[model samples]
Target: MIHPLDKAPEQGEAGLLKRLLRAGLPVAPTVAVALEEEFLRLANLQEQIGLLFQGVFGARIDEERLFYAAERAESLVRESYLLPERAEAFLGSLKGWQGPFLVRDSGRSPFAQARTPQEALFALKRLYASRYRVEEVLERWPRLFPTLDLVLVQEAGAPQEDPGLSLKAAELLGQPARVEAWEGRVVRVILD
Candidate 1:
């Protein structure tokens, strides 16, 4: 879903295709619009895939897991235009949460993964500035084509939180169910 930098503005629908001309420079088309497009892209993907996933799996998937799988998981990968460009690594959600998060921005190249307040500030800026879920265009990010490569929102590293909420006890359906994880975070489900 990648388009050349020169032509990105024209095809505004495909935000994933748009690339920042210079990684060091401020994000093109202003930071606000970029943010809108980013969230719109995410929300749209959620809309398209969420329905299908719920239909097949018959279980609700969290926004974090859906976005992560859309970006990284092999089983969830699909050649859909609703997806982000490979040029941009999928950073997980950045909204409705608190601090102590490690934002990964592997835009063009990799750099020191500073777990300092600097990265957190950058994410906060994106969170506050970008206008993604608005009734608008083009999105916000706080995750623009700036120096950021990946935008992380959940537990850093591969590990995720598992409170061991039993499906049998919660659902109370007496149906067999299983929860699976990748590197500790729950990623898959099996129900019978």
Candidate 2:
């Protein structure tokens, strides 16, 4: 049987993919680009699998290769984009080949729910930063924040009278005067 990696790149993507998987290569950039399309060419998809596996294995390529590659790919796809800032860090640490192979998820937010006025305000601020204006989020889901409720708890550390973002947030929300000051920058209003 021909080793998957040894197959010619042109055997179309299917044959090439089979070869690559059998050979245990990492993911390919071509595959990454194709991921946008609804359907994928198997050969190209195999390429991406190879590239991801390569990144995870680092220098110790041969030992425990399949196990490490699978774990790395899963972690990258699952958590990377959600917390983009930590994505690179996570990748870098994996390359060094130290520490536990798996990191457990401890499901607990210090402030569980946005019950209190302060919690509600913080939630809204984070929503604006991470979820609201993010291009991908908006592109994928258009009517995301049509009915948002913003409640101000304490004044965000903006200039006293200026109220920097607080006012702007209200305008963006299309509910300015509806904004009510609770404590500081926190205010409560429903998105109507």
Candidate 3:
């Protein structure tokens, strides 16, 4: 089956990332698992949580109690199996990729950081589990739950040569900032 990330734009940040790459930006290559798949995983996880807790607490558990239960259930998410084909495709895409990777959330207020493959996989599981975290739930309580469907698996970019540029930019902007430089060229300006 064609994984959603294989297509452009429609698969969320994958499209934007591709466009950036084509435009000669310094972003590394990435692969992603679609939102639909994540939705299914989340739904299944919720069902499993219900089953596991129903006998002990019954179905009338309040949101606070449910949040606790969800935290406990997070460990199970690491064991949730990925489809063999999808796993193969994801791994295959990074066959010869060297250095560390980055597993990032592709949603509003996205965060990105570097990791090895094993670390990235663990992070991915945690990212999924984070959907039900107490703080996350509180943040999205009004929305019921915010969308957290996409994962960005990208090769780690080279380290900044003069990280002082970030400090300088922050000083000038009167806010935190990061400078992403590659091949002696300043590629990105991130403000915080």
What is the overall TM-score of model 3 with all chains considered together? 0.63
How many residue pairs collide in each prediction? 15, 26, 0
What is the clash count of model 1? 15
Top of the candidates by TM-score? 3
* lDDT tens readout by residue for model 1, 1-192: 222233334322112212212212121121111332454355454354344334221245355543443333222222322234422322223233333333322221111222433464345334422212221111332232222222322223332323352242224324453432234333222343
- Residues 1-192, candidate 3: write the lDDT tens digits: 223333545444455444445555455555665543553465486567545444333345366676666676666565676666655666666677774666666533334454555566566666776665666655664443447556766665543644765565456546676655444433344656
Would you list the C-alpha lDDT of every candidate in the order shown? Answer: 0.30, 0.29, 0.55
TM-score of each: 0.20, 0.16, 0.63
- Ranking of candidates on TM-score, top first: 3, 1, 2
Q: Please tell me which model should have the higher lDDT, number 2 or number 3.
A: 3
RMSD of each: 19.9, 23.1, 6.3
Give the top-scoring candidate (lDDT): 3
How much lDDT does candidate 2 score? Answer: 0.29
